[model samples]
Target: MHNDVEEILFSKEDISRKVKELGEKISKDYNRDDEVVVVGVLKGANVFMADLIREIDIPVYIDFMAVSSYGYSTESSGIVRILKDLDLEIEGKHVLIIEDIIDTGLTLKYLTDNLKSRNIKSLKICTLLDKPKRRKCDLNIDYIGFEIPDKFIVGYGIDYGEKYRNLPYVASLKEETYK
Candidate 1:
């Protein structure tokens, strides 16, 4: 897995520190009586969400939603599909959407719009990586750990063809590796 990487972007230590920082900020901002629910976008965000929630020293709940916009492709198809919805009803709850990466932002926009209809008290997005250069839709991601370039990134819960997600650091894949 490491050999396929062209260059390491964020080391394991780097990601850990960033997650801790984001968690502390979230803990401080949403430190209230209202229940704070961390909604993680499945598969890609599994590792990030797991590490982030531990840093948060508040009573919060966790839920997973499996969404698909890219299937067997690195680029999004512009259409978002919810494979699995949240089990908990978030109406009037403080909802925080956690994601692994924000590339085109179309899927996240669609998701946020859908969640907004639930009449939640508050809604925000926290993404581990942001590719602003590739953004096609408008999005307000409250917590961003890294603003990365538009590249084929893998590792640290991100993947190429569902591989490399177990790697501890973020890395750019070699062009030949994908081809």
Candidate 2:
């Protein structure tokens, strides 16, 4: 699996430090009284979400949302479909959307819109990776671990052909692996 990587973008240490910093900021911004819910986008964000939540000092409810915009293709299909929904109601709660990466942002936009309709008290986005070069819609990420160039990255729960998720670092995939 390591052989398929072209370059390492964020190492385990780097991600750990950043996630800790983000957690501290989140702790400071929201009080324990605030009904905080951390909603992780499934599969890709599993690792990041796990690490991030531990760093957060305040108690937070956790949930998972499985939306698909990509199947076997490397790029998004531009259509967001919900494969799984939240088990708990988020109305009047401070909701934070946890994502592994934000590329085209279309799928997230669709999700944000859907979540907004639920009448949550607040909504924010926290992503481990942001590809501003690939953004196709206006979006604001409240917390960002790294701003990366447009590339095919997989690791730390992100996958290619459902492989490479166990790699300890985030890395760009080799061209030949996908080509």
Q: Report, for every candidate in turn, its global Cα lDDT versus the true structure.
A: 0.93, 0.93
Q: Which pairs in model 1 have colliding backbones?
A: none
- How do the residues 54-170 of candidate 1 rate in per-residue lDDT, one tens digit apiece? 999989989999998998887799999999999998988999999999999998999999999999999999999999999998899899999999899999898899999999999
Q: Give the runs in model 1 whose Cα sits over 4 Å from its true position.
A: none
Each candidate's TM vs. the true structure?
0.98, 0.98
Q: What is the lDDT of candidate 2?
A: 0.93
Instruction: Supply every candidate's count of residue pairs whose N, Cα or C atoms clash at under 3 angstroms.
Output: 0, 0
Query: Could you tell me the lDDT of residue 27 within candidate 1?
Result: 89
lDDT of 2 by residue, 1-179 (tens): 38888999989999899999999999999988999999999988999999999999998999999998887889889999999999989999999999999999998999999999999999999999999999999997899989999889999999888888899899998899999
